[model samples]
Target: MVNLIYDKSPIFLQNIFISLKGIQIYRQRYNKVYRKELKILNEENEFNLQKKRFKSFIKYTRKNSPFYSQKLSHLKKEISMSDIELLPMLTKDEIREHVDEIVTRNKGLLPMGTSGTTGKKLIIYSHPYDISRRIAYLDYFKAKHGVKKGMKRASMGGRTFVPEKQKSHIYWRHNYILNQLLFSIYHASNENIIYYIEELNRFKPQSIDGVTTVIYRIAKYINKHSIELTFKPIAIFPTAETLTVTVKSEIEKAFRCKVFDQYSSSEGAPFIVENDKGYYDICPATGYYELERIEGNIYEITVTSFYTTTTPLIRYRIGDAVELFDTLPENYTQSDIKIKRIIGRKNDYLVSNEKGKVYSAILSATVRKTEGNFIECQFIQNKMDEVIINFVIEGVNDKKTIEHSIKELMKVRFSESTEYNVRFVEELESTDGGKTRFIINNLNRELS
Candidate 1:
């Protein structure tokens, strides 16, 4: 069988065999989810079907999950979609504290966890249904960009394929199963980045999928050195971190391809994708999304995954903020959900002593104008008055030039009283799950 060949074949032949098998498997799974999605999509009232699925999910969780049973006992008397919303929103702390009770009949479940960027990591189980549905949606996104399964692709993200300590020759690992050339973010540097460029040029992948930081760094290097790519990718996909305008522009210029931003989490609850129309289109089938307004045009997103029965995330309050749009734009492809833009997390803003609160866009613009040579940056704040700027230097710039530029930029954004510290680093580290955080704030102040 092809599956047997994929498992037992040597590395060289494995890419071909695995590509064939992966296509067949993805096709079967994609059709299953696609058929269901089409049924909901064609309906005159889609929320009516969503409501039914939500009720069934609530019943399944209440009957099997001990944690949900106790939490939803009050609503058991009169179950409805409106009543489900009345239940207390699930928090990451609650999930971490009662992971065992949250899981239901874990016979064929896979354990998973988040990157723990906020100092609280949630551990849960991945349901088989969730995995299949996720693959189907991923295929959908790739199809939109004219990509098919088993295509030669280059990926640079959080996975530690090459060990962090080994930095010299081997900067990449190839996966025969997916026909992918995996570039390690840890090993990307000035002395070693050329090897990554060489491997990418050698593979000539049709698509390059990676975190924004890694992809941006590679793109910046290529542009700076005026090195032309051997082969052009049809599309560039960015995930795992927030995609900024500056990075997106740089990446598009470097690759000479359109960049599609894909947003999802390990929790398997929500899915958002950048469509050809330049909109952050949301998929309604993945989760029931609810928005809580924090300020002007900014709302906190809370979601409940309809497919996650093993460890159901119902009304889970993930700390993410986004611009609000009540309706989708004209000529939009998808339906039922609308998000104007993702404004990073609640902690991405700086609580200035004078300017009230400054969002990531403001800080990003300031840094881009001042320090254009830095490939990547992270703004860290531990207090209201002090800000630390962490940057990975790509060019040979003196310390004083970089420091003075950052200080001048900070003065324009924050008050003159606010202190600035600039730290030059070799590379930024990704979280345990391979996600890179652009902004890290340790203070306990409320997000405005």
Candidate 2:
């Protein structure tokens, strides 16, 4: 049975419930033991450990799960990364189609959904074990940054804690259970922003976590208005969206604290965070990852979950891109995987004439699935009813093939009256964070 109460519960109560739930009890025990292992396990050792765990997981799925059993019936018993590569890539569409068959014979099943940066909502499954590890992953980084559990903190992501159209001074909801102050991002108007800052001052959270753009808005407001804060937070963790250099810099200056960025998905495949050493490091305890190069230096991240038993997301191709690092720093001899930048996930959007918003992820997936040697691509939307696709092609014998494919997909998803322009660009540009912006929507004004 699905419980909507837990899904919409305050973050603190949800965390408490996870610790007390049936399967989660064992998961908590397992995590208590595994935390010790995580301390000594270096990047290389963690890879080997996850490799062993992955093989076991595959065997478990093949014996029980109808989806994997049929998919891997022909493969040999000995599983290798190269051998796994031979298997068909799993997309979000496949999960939506085969959700019932993908689930394992496990209890404490939980339904989860992605924020849907790709235009379409993606529903995935998880269990107590998965949730435990996820919380632990963030806690590990929190500990590194001198943040402890039960401490005063504030979060201002996509959640609508405060309802819009309600004229009131209260712009936040207090969660006394976790000593957390939940701010609303939907009401980020000039008038509402003052209440948000006022609440932060009154509550005096030790740390703040929020969406990249939302937090940047608060920081920009502080700088522009010269609004003096009563208290300074120890650290700021920006998540959900790409963290640009300008956003990070402005946030650090405004809050007088460090910014720690992180990346992950609802699929529970791989957990990654900005380490204290200043690099995007994958949490070895979370899952295994295989990087598939889609274009020049830009690779699509494929992941397999090690924690979840209800859903086996093996070799799942999440529609996000990242840039690989060529060399490692001399001091960092522990990490095997080195990632310099995360280009971005599909989070761009388009607005219709009637103010209907369309996700950029829909367009990104369409072009990515096309059979062509496109080196790089970006979707730019300046007007409400128009779109410009800026793409870089290495060399294609039939350029018309690419154009036809894009237009064909566009026609199906968008209105016939919408104006579409395909522009062939020599090179795409990167953001201040040294990462490429896949979806650029200038119409959605940034914080001044």
- TM-score for every candidate vs. truth? 0.68, 0.69
lDDT of 1: 0.71
List ranges where model 1 is wrong by over 4 Å: 1-49, 76-80, 164-168, 325-337, 345-448
User: Once all C-alphas are superposed, what RMSD does model 2 give against the true structure?
Assistant: 10.2
Which residue ranges in model 2 land beyond 4 Å of their true spot? Answer: 1-45, 78-82, 163-165, 327-336, 345-447
Candidate 1 lDDT, tens digit per residue, 1-448?
Answer: 7545444545446446435655665555556655565444445354565667777888888899999889878765546566655877988778877979998776868777553344223567975566766776676678778987679988875543343234348766666657788776545545567788888888899999976766877888899999999888999898777887888999999989999998777777668789887778766656677777778767777888776778888899877777857643333322535677888654666766765555444454455446445556677788987988777766665567878887986775555788888888787645455756666766797732
Backbone clash total, candidate 1: 0
Cα deviation of 223 in candidate 2 (Å)?
A: 1.4
Give the alpha carbon lDDT tens digit for every residue of 1-448 in model 2.
2245665565556545543452434445346544654454423366677667777877887888888889888989768554666677788788877988888865667887542443333558886666656666676678789887678999885543333234566656665555666776545545457778887888888899975655777788899999999998989998766887777889998899888888886577677788776668887656777776666666677877777667887878777777767643333322546787788643365554432444443344455445555655666777766888766876766467767777765654444567878777787655556655666677854323
Look at candidate 2 and tell me the lDDT of residue 248: 86
Per-model clash counts, in order, read: 0, 0
- Indicate the residue-level lDDT of 50 in model 2: 67
- Candidate 2, 367: how far from true, in Å? 22
